[model samples]
Target: MSNNNNFRLPYFLLLLILLSSSDFLPSVFAKSQNPITDSEIKKKKSECYADIDSGLWGGHCKSSSIAKENCALKCLSPACYELIYESDPLEEGEKDYIRGQEYKYCMYKLSVGESLEGVRGSFDY
Candidate 1:
C-alpha cells in the first residue's frame, strides 16, 4: 500500500507539470496556422479603398479630403488608417506645410477633373 502511495505522488506531480506546460503548446501551433502576411493586409486595404471609391459612405470620390477622411474611418487596421490619412508625427510648421501642399494638389486635380485616387497616388504621404 505504501509503495502504491509513493508511486501515485510522482504521477500526480508529472500530470501537474504536463498540464501547466500545455498552455504554451497551442501558441506554438497557432503561430503557424494564423499567418497574416503583408499581401493579405494590402488586399484588405485595396478592398477598403474600393468601397470608399464606390461612394458607399455618401461621399463623392472626387473630394479628396472627404474621401480621405472616410477612408480613414473605414480602414481595417491602424496601419491602413495611416496610409490613407498620412498623418505621421510632424512638427506644427511641417504639418501646416504638408496640409497646404495637399490642398493645392487637390485643387489642381479638381480643376483638371482628375479623380482623388490619382492625386492619392501622386503624393508620397
Candidate 2:
C-alpha cells in the first residue's frame, strides 16, 4: 500500500503542476483573420494522402474507402493534433482517448483562430 501511494504521489504532483501552470497549457483561441490558409490545408491534405500510402493504416484501412478517407482527413485537418493524438502516451482504452478529444476541440478552436494558446509569444503546446 505504501509503495502504491509513493507511485501515486508523483502522478498527483504532475497533475497538479499541469493544472496550475497556465503557461504549460495550450491557448483556447487566438485572433486571426485566417488561421489556416487554403494552400496550407491543401498541402496538408496532400501530404496526408501520401502518408497513408505506406503506413499500417494503409494496409488495414484501405479496403474500406470511407475509413481510409476519414483517416486521411484526420491527418490533414490538424496535422500536429493527429500526430500527437495518434502517439499520445495513453492508448485506446478507458479514458485514454482524452488527447484525441482535446485535439478535436483544439481543431474546432483553431478553425476559428490561429493561436490555440494565446500565450503572449510561443509556438509550443
Candidate 3:
C-alpha cells in the first residue's frame, strides 16, 4: 500500500503541476474576447460571416473578394470599422443605403471588378 501511494503521489503531483502551467492546456476550449462592443458585434454579425482562415483560402468571394476579406474582419474592434469605412468606395448615400440594406452586401460588392481593379491599380504600392 505504501509503495502504491508513493507511485500515486508522484502522478498526482505531476498532474497538479501540469495543470498549474498553461502550456500543457488545450487551446480549443479557451475563452477569447472580441474587444468590440455589443453594438459592433451585432452590427458585424449582421454584416457578414466568413469561415476563419481554415489553412485554405477556400475560394474567394469571386465578386467582392477584397470587400469580403475586409468585412470578414469586421468582427474586429470598432477602431477597425472606422479604418475600413474610410476606404470603402460607396458614396455617402450609397454607403448609407448599403449599410441599411446589408453591410455584407456592400462588402460583397467591394470584392468586384472596377472597384477592386481600380484599387489594385491606383493604390499600387
Candidate 4:
C-alpha cells in the first residue's frame, strides 16, 4: 500500500505539471500568431512623437533632439527597437554609436517605403 501511494504521488505531480504546461503553451502560440500591424505602428509612432513634443519622449529616451529622433525610430520599427534596446548593453563608445546609426538607418529605410526584408535583411537576426 505504501509503495502504491508513492507511485501514484509521482504520477499525480507529473499530471499536474503537464496540465499547467498545456494551458500555458497555447497562449504563447496565440500571442506569437498576432503580428504587429501597420495601424498599430502608426499609432505607436504618433504617441512617441507626442511624447517627444511634450518633453516626455516615452519615459525612456533622453531629453534631446537626437534621443527623441532615436525614440521615434524605435516606434517606427520593432526590429530597430529590439536591436537598440533589447540587445545586450555595450560600453558607451564608437561601436555603440555605429550600431545606433545602423539601426536608425534601417528604420529610416523602412519609413521611406523600403521593404522590411531589404532594410533588415531578415526579420530574425
CA RMSD of all predictions: 14.2, 15.4, 15.5, 9.7
Expressed as tens digits, the lDDT of each residue in 11-105 for candidate 4 is: 99987787689676676454344454567666878887886677664555655555665667665666766755545533323245555655656
Q: Candidate 3 at residue 111, lDDT?
A: 30
Model 4 misplaced regions, further than 4 Å: 1-23, 28-31, 58-68, 75-119, 123-125
Comparing 3 and 4 on TM-score, the stronger one: 4
Q: Tens digit of lDDT per residue, candidate 1, span 1-125?
A: 99999989999998878667867656544334434454755676577677777766456543665555445334544433343345642222334445434434554444444455644445456
Give the winner by lDDT: 2 or 4.
4
**lDDT string, candidate 3, 12-117, tens digits:** 9998988877766644344333333447556665455534343232445323545455445454323334434546633322434323334333333343311322
Residue clash pairs of candidate 3: 63-111, 64-111, 65-111
Model 3 residue-pair collision total: 3
TM-score for each predicted model, relative to the true structure: 0.33, 0.37, 0.24, 0.41
For all candidates in order, the CA lDDT equals 0.52, 0.58, 0.45, 0.61
**TM match of model 4 to true structure:** 0.41
Where is model 4 poorest over a 10-residue stretch in terms of lDDT? 116-125
Residues 15-100, model 2: lDDT tens digits:
98987778655443325445556677678767877788778455754655555665765676545445444453332233534454
